[model samples]
Target: MSGLREPYGRGADEAGFTLVEMIVALAVFSLLSVLLFHNVKFGVQAWRSGSARADELQRSVVTQELLRRLLGNAYPLIIKQEALQPRIDFEGGSEAVEFLSEAPVVSGGAGRYRFKLFVDRTRQQTDLVMTAAPELASAQDNSASRTLLVSDIDHAELAYFGAPSPGAPGRWNDSWEKQSDVPSLVRLRVSFHASDPRTWPDLVVALRVRADVSCVYDPITARCRGR
Candidate 1:
């Protein structure tokens, strides 16, 4: 009897878990799993937001740099026009004002840079094309000299602001084609949409086009020179 009772006591001690103990263990595990899942979800959201902000910042910087280079190098070119009617091609499929300048030091070459803004109907975006002028010798007769600089724009606009000549009123010129010479300052406005809305920068950039030696001087200076 003593031996049997000792064996029974051992068996009782090694018995399976009670209902209350099992329920408590399961509840603790479920709580821990919920906490871990929430932590992971929070981390993923933070990473995505951070990545989106970084991408937007990068795109803004790139767009500003390209705009600066193009506007800083603008120059005047003659436009072909008929006798009485004055017309100039500003953008879209029409001819554009050509400005020639040495490539930026970053480009590492003295190639000619041509800048033009054209609308891409298919893409529903504006494109800024930049091309390097062909070398004299290797240049092909049918080959175009220009290269693409930056594209994928929503819209690009040019506004002239400066001392308007005698008869003209101060206003935003939708097209700057009629001006025989480049204005003292040009206000460039660009708008675009980003794939990620949170990352898009305010789309406005104003640039002053560089002046050339051929630019007209003040009338006072001309009179003084005549004296």
Candidate 2:
């Protein structure tokens, strides 16, 4: 009987895990799982944040380029009013700017257009908008189109750089006063709310065409005589 071994059964090494050992193993596995989950979550969040920033940057660049093209193609066109004095079709103010432009924001429509850029404010949001109308629109013509340029703006200011009169000292003015001539330079400054992430660089554009280049100035009428 002593020589004969016990029935074939579990040995000490074959006992399998104890309750405490099993608990410890489970704890270790749970800890590792938690750590891995957090790492994956953090990586995903970072990727999303980076993508959002890149999209915002791209949108800002496109907006700036569009503004540059529109402002750079400003035209010096003169419009004659019925029984009124002829004006150079350029008007600038502190909060708004209107002028004749050779380039239209919307494609396909080709001739000269009257462009107006201004800020629209509401309780929910503030936006910078552009309004375009036909250059030869009659007084009764109410056909005009509006386009939203940028949103969430605090303010938009426009200034003109030129002399009030010919041969006078040039200076920056809040508004363009001379109706017969166009300003030499136009400046646009836009700002956003403190909470907004977007920023705008100041845009200063020089007028390409001179209003009096091929025209004769009539001091008597304070206007350009020839087109």
Q: Find the candidate with the highest lDDT and give its number.
A: 2
lDDT of 1 at 72: 55
Cand. 2 Cα-lDDT: 0.78
Error of 2 at 141 (Å): 4.4
The stretch of ten residues in a row with the least summed lDDT in candidate 2 is 218-227
Q: All candidates' lDDT scores? A: 0.50, 0.78
Instruction: Report residue 169 deviation for candidate 2 (angstroms).
Output: 2.6
- Write out the backbone clash pairs for model 2: none
Candidate 1 weakest lDDT stretch, 10 residues:
86-95
Give model 1's TM-score versus the native structure.
0.59
Cα-based RMSD of candidate 1 = 7.8
Give me the displacement of residue 98 in model 2, in angstroms.
0.8
lDDT of 2 at 42: 99
